[model samples]
Target chain A: MTFVTITFFLFLAVAFLCYFVMPKQHRWLVLLAFSIAFYLFAGWEKFLFVLASALIAYLVGRKGTKSSLVFGIVSIVLLLFYAKAGNSILAAFQMKESIIVPLGISYYSFSIIGYMLDVYYKKIECEKNFFAFLLYMIYFPQILEGPIPRYKKLAPQLMEGHEFSYERFCFGAQRALWGYFKKLVIADRIALYTGEVFSNYKDYSGIYFFVAVLLSSLQLYTDFSGCMDIALGVSQCFGITLDENFRRPFFSKNAAEFWRRWHITLGTWFKDYVYMHLAIHPKLLKLSKLAKDKVGKRFGKSLITIIPLAVVWLLTGLWHGTGADYILWGCYWGIIIILSTVFAKEWKQVNQFLKIDGNSKGFSRFQMIRTFFVFSGARLLTAPGDLKVSAYMFRHMFSLWSFREFFTKGALVGILSVWDVVIVIIGTLILWKVDLLQEQGVEIRKKIGQYPIPLRWVFYYGLFFATLVFGIYGPGYQASDFVYIQF
Target chain B: MEEEILELLSAEFPEVDFTASDELVDDGLLDSLTITGIIATLSMEYDIEIPYEEIIEENFNSIAGLASMVERLQEN
Candidate 1:
């Protein structure tokens, strides 16, 4: 069951109640039961896949041998590849649909592989209990669209069940309410416009495509980060802290910084597992020396960045999807990052030549806006889910750019209703303001908690009621699934 | 060792001030790419292999950390 549904809320309530009621040592048992039930609630058909994958991981980790490590990594990677790319490969062979991909296969598979690698590398002692490892692989809060947890970081917390605290609950509830506001009030509302414009771009003008790309970018950020918020908030209520997946990504001044902030867990995963390893690999290091001696110091130094980043970006793209559009999107980001790193000094020199203080607040703001548009350009490539439409949008994206029409009833007539536009605009402003404050190191939830009881209750219940009242939930309106769940 | 390594790294990466911050890795002075470059330079110059376990932040945060790590690895 999706987090947005009433049934899931009921499930969470039951889980929450049982967790606090149970003894501390047995609380993990409660969590395990709830996690399994949550998975089964989604469907029993894919249950075996998760179980078997967990078993494989357990076996590999228990063995902790070189061969088993290879086996573990290969099997997990191949399973992920089959699940992600099976449909495309089947289509190529003119076969019908063949694979029933398990829930959170992409996420759990990576977690398990990371576990196996850690085991072989002797980073942490392998968990002696199979059930504990299984629980780590299938934690209910993180199973769907994870800030994918690391074993060393998350497993010990899972085993050591925490006593219930009123503070954690309040903090979690407030954060979750904010997440609901982002998803239901902002993202879903904007989806009405982006959904239509992307699906039927031919019906609208060039300005519409541009608007849709920007909106879809917001839709994705809200929907994905909204899910992360719910995941982390729910986990916190149970006295566990998951990693933060987003960090005001829109304010990033460059592609590298943006990736560092956005989907932070995924970026760290690639860096730790893939990029760092490749950079330190003997062969590549030798190649770097060769290039330095033969070509130049700069070129050799850049080789470290170029080679590992190329592989990391390609794999990153494939992880997102096996589609050509995703490949293009991945390459689009990869090239920008690689070039920026390779020519950072040259760019600085050029900036100096142009007499622009790159560190100035105005210039930083300009860079942030530039990064947003660059992100929106990548959105244009894959948001339509087809490269042809993306190409067409690119060709005519600036055709009928009339600000008067855009600002007036032109946007209101069918594209976006007055209410829809208002909610999204207000939501965007609130999101921006909150992010700005947080960027300046304000702990918003803590600040709210410091208020007197009456005022605190007002802030808490005000948000709760706002989400309940303004959230787009009525007959004829279906809440969109958290966007990253499909990945 | 600190002065020599600082000179070496400064000469290698003219963009960064090696002695500006002790928390180089934590303060974002040394990104992953730069860290790898430092590892390469250290490995090639010192003729010692730095294991993956040695890649922690404490070892890369400052020149003293690097010099100590290199000394320990060499003694090993």
Candidate 2:
């Protein structure tokens, strides 16, 4: 029942229809039923983990004590830990593996932890209704891959019944249409090329490996953000506005700015919960002061940024996965961001020394390109799914241009046919142009709305049929799951 | 007190306009980084420890808010 399937759409149609027909106060009941149905379709075992987390939060929220807050958070983190690595630990103990990693445990675990912290800090009144808490915790749209809702904002909206709005429904359907186009047409097409190149890294070199690295980055972007579009769009049809997760990330000019725009919800979650908490802790503050008196003021100030950022990045890496490559990936970004920030004055000085206009459009384009390659470097680390294969790809990446080989060989990557390559390129360009328009603050859907009904329907049906016909779904091209769902 | 603190902060972060808005944090004038910088700066200058609970937007929204927090911390 992934977003890329007809079954999910049928389920979605039923949910959306029932939602509008139910009595105003009873609409949430329909949502709850469908939400449970969606989870049950996935597996009943996964819901037990969600249920336990919800029950812990509900009990701690009702108790409303600091100790319960500690208890709740620790209990939730351990539950998440077991789901992440319990089997491995059990294997080491000569024990049978018996933990079931629930779907979207990473997403909900963070939500519940953040909710508990907010309640203890008196940021929001504790949620009294266990059912409402459960609904927010396991809301179907965001439960799988999340924008990671804040409790105060999403809980009330979940409980409140929304009247049907024609404009909203149109906007949502159009958004989902775009999502399907990206997921089916663009991402899966590129996946056909990248999957083969990455899996058989030994056979490719030079231009092939280089192109694979670049496409893998875009493959992830479209796949994950495509899913976000589906989730947010589906939620919006019911008058719920989930927080956005991507903001034209590839256009960012540096690693720091890139993170600010990419996977934005996850970054904000860490900033609020981990970075801010550590930065303002009295002990770290005291340590910084002592360093100032003992060593130097600049060194002391650097500590404030370095320590928290390192911890956040490490935890961010761990949250992504408990892998050696992911940890190094964390350190990779961490080091770049820390160095750039701590030496921001020096970076500006170097740009000045090189006679580069830091703010000019051309220089900004250069910076965007640099950020892209820097991002591709991080992708190179993780995309291979193994450290040694990544090293082999890196070492043999620059042997020769081999344009003749790439063209004269069996299409691209020995698997992608000519039409597949054409579709990927054309689809990629359309994605780029649309993202560029949105970057410039153009409301594309609104522009389409302003067109006469006949033309608008033409564009809509054109996209719909385009996805149906061109989407990669035949033999050997499976509809890949949204990339972020595994996280 | 607000005047003195504003003068000091302006000297430290000359690029910022402390008087631009009463809702600096709410209005996006102060970000998380700038807020952390302000904490480090005030902690060093006034020799006061700002606790975790005091790291809210209300305290860092404007120089006036910051001055009050600093005064309260300095007294304690």
Candidate 3:
């Protein structure tokens, strides 16, 4: 069940009660049961995929052989590949209908494989208990989408039954409420505009496309990060601390730093497992040496680094989807990062020669704004089904034709009213304020907690009533699913 | 040994006082990119092959840790 629905809250409430009420030793068992129930609630047919994955990982982790590790890793990758790409393969064979790609397959597959690999490398001990491993694989909060927790990080917390603490519960509840506010008030409202323009780009051009596309970046950030907040918040109520996924990504000064801040778990996963491994692999070392001799040092190092980076980005793209546009978007980012790395020294030198104070606050702001636009522009490739449509929209954006139509009330009020626009602006400003506070290392939740009871109650109830009133929910509007869930 | 490691770190990241903090990795002093650059330079300068398994926080958290890690690797 999605987080927005009443059914999910009901499920969480029941699960929470069962967890606390059960005998201490059996609390973990209760979680396992609830996780299974949550999975089954999504679909009974997909239950087998999760179970099989857990079983394979557990068995292979126990074996801990070179061949077994290879087999286990390969099996998981193949399973993920087939689930993701199976339909396209069947279409080539002239099949009438394609199979459904199971939910959480991409996410759970990575978590499981990471566990087995850790076992293989002796980073963590093998999980001997099948049930514990299964619970780790299918924890309901992270199952839909993930910050992609490692076994070492998540498994022990699941086993350590937590005593109910009022402080923890309040923090988690407030966090979840914040998530709901962002998802409903900000993300969903903007989705009405972005969803319209992306689907039917031909109907409008110039500023309409510009506004929708730019706002889409904000919509995506709030939606995905909002889901993360809810997931992490729910886990926190259970006294589990999942690794954080975002860290004020918009404040990053460059593309490299932006990626490091955004989706931190996934980036670290690829870094630890894929990029770093290949960077130091024997074959790559030999290649780097040969390239160093054949070409200049800078060129050679770039050549070696570029290959693994390209692989990571390509897989990152495919992980999003098998679509050509996704692949193009991946390469676009890969190129940007690679260019930055290769010319980093020269770029610094050029800035210094030009007497630019790269460390100054003004320069930092300029960099942030530049990075934001570049990131938004790259998102255009992801918004449209066809790359040509993105190109057309971009062309119209630059053409300045019919630009006067942009500021007119007629265009802006088509999807949402002026009041709706005002709400969105205010909501965005709040989000920005919160992120800025976090970037400056302010403990906002703790600060809120320090307030007197009356003020605290006022703060909490104010948010609750505001969400109830202003949230984009009603009989006509279906709650849009979190964007990252598809991945 | 600490001084040698400090010299290496200073050459790589001139902005940070590497010796001031023992928790270089724990603090925000050394990022992943800087860590990778240090590893590459150490590998080349010392003629030591630091494998992926050795690239852990414990081995690179401070000048002393880094020096000790390099000495152990060199001996091996």
Candidate 4:
């Protein structure tokens, strides 16, 4: 069940009650049962996929054989590909086409692969117990959209019995409420405009297209990061800490740093497992040497770095999908990152020549805004359909720029109501204020906790009711699924 | 070896005092970009193929750590 659903909350309540009432040693078993039950609710067929993944990881990790490791990883990769592109692959082979994407197969397959690699490399010991392994692999809260927990990071916590703490419960409840606020109040509300404007790009031009594209980017962030917050908050109730996925990524000064802060676990996974390995491969080393001989030391070495980065980006693109638009989106960011690095020296020189103080607050703010637009522009490639639509939208956006259209009745009324606009503006301001406070190292929760009980309850109840009243739902609006869950 | 590593680090990260700081990675004195550059330079300068497994914090967090890792790799 989705995080926003009433059924999921009921399930969580039952699971939490069962977990706490059980014996300390048997608590983990309860968690495993709940995890399996959660997966089963999605689909029994999908349940088998996760079970197979857990089994494969455990067997390969336990065996610790070289050939088995290779076999396991390759098998897992193929399974992932099937989950991602099974229909197309079947069609290619002239078989009956069926969409067989197992729920969370893409996410958990990576977790299993990572576990097997770590086992083979002897980074962490193999988890001998099957149930413990399954519990870690298919933890219900993070099973769907993940922070992609590592075995070393998550397994022990899963196995260790946690005594319920009132403080932990409060924290988790508040965090989950905040996550709902972001998803329901901000992302779902904005998705309407983005969904309309992007799907009907021809009908809208100039300022509308740009506004829609920017909203899409914001919606993506809020939705995905909101999912992570819910996952983390749920896990926190059990005293399990998942990795932080977003770190105020909008404040990033460049595309490279933006990536480092966004979907952090996925980036690090590729870095540690894929990029680093490819960067130091013998073939790449040969290429590096050749470049160094042909060109100079710095540029050649930069080429060496770019080669692996390109591979990472390509895989990253394919990881999202086999779609042309997805590949283009990946390449767009890859080129931006590569250009930033290639022109590092020249950019610095230009800044100095232009008497731009790189450290000034104004400069930093300018960089943040510039990075936001760059990221937002890149996200246009992720619009519905192929690159052609994005191209047309871009052409229209730049070629037909008009200030008056942004304020025109057609522009505002076609997508959102005046009330919706007001709500979105206020919601965004609240989100930014909270994020800014957190960025300044303010422990907001703790600060609130220190307040008198009446004040604290007032704040909590205010947020809870605000989420209830202002959240977009019922009647015409369906609970919008998180953006990253498709991947 | 420490002095040589310090020299290399200083050459790459001209702003940082590598000699004074021990928690270079921890303190954010050395980010991944700088770390990658150092790895390339060290691999080239010392003719050692630093494996992916060796790219851990303990191996590159400080001047001594880097020098010790290089020495150990050389011996191997």
Among the numbered candidates, top lDDT falls to: 1
Candidate 1: chain B TM-score equals 0.96
True contacts kept of 4: 0.19
List model 2 lDDT by residue over A329-370, tens digit each: 999999999999889889999999999988899999999999
Q: Which stretches of model 1 miss by more than 4 angstroms?
A: A402-410, B1-3, B15-23, B26-28, B71-76
TM-score of chain A of each: 0.98, 0.97, 0.97, 0.96
What tens digits encode model 4's per-residue C-alpha lDDT throughout A18-137? Answer: 999999888999889998998888889888887787788899999999999998999899889887788777888999858768888777888888999898888899999998998999
Task: Give the candidates in order of TM-score, highest first.
Answer: 2, 1, 4, 3
Q: Write the per-residue lDDT of candidate 1 for residues A1-487, one digit (tens) a residue.
A: 9889999899999999999899889999998999999999878878888898899889999999889989888988888998899888999999986878888988898888888878788888898898999899999999999988899999999989898899899788778888998999898888888888878878777788888899889999999999889998999999999989999999999999999999998999999889989988878888888999999987887888899999999899889899999898889999999999899889999999999999899999999999999999999988888999999988888798877777775678667878778878888998999999999999999998788999999977877887788788878777988889988
Most DockQ-accurate candidate: 1
Tens-digit lDDT track for model 1 on B1-76?
A: 8888888989888888878899999999998888988998988788778878789889999999999999999999
The DockQ-based CAPRI class assigned to model 1 is medium
* TM-score of each predicted structure versus truth: 0.96, 0.97, 0.94, 0.95
- Candidate 3 residue-wise lDDT, A37-117, digit = tens: 988987887898888888999999999998998999999998888887888789989998977666789889989888988
Weakest 10 consecutive residues of candidate 3 chain A by summed lDDT = A403-412
Give, for candidate 4 chain A, the lowest lDDT window spanning 10 residues: A405-414
Clashing pairs in 4: none
Q: Candidate 3 chain B, which ten residues in sequence have the lowest lDDT sum?
A: B32-41
Alpha-carbon interface RMSD for all candidates, in angstroms = 1.3, 1.6, 2.4, 1.8
What global local distance difference test value does model 4 have?
0.85
Q: What C-alpha lDDT do the candidate models reach, one value each? A: 0.89, 0.88, 0.85, 0.85
Query: Which residue pairs in candidate 2 have backbone atoms (N, alpha carbon, C) closer than 3 angstroms, thus clashing?
Result: none
Q: What is the DockQ of each candidate?
A: 0.60, 0.56, 0.37, 0.48
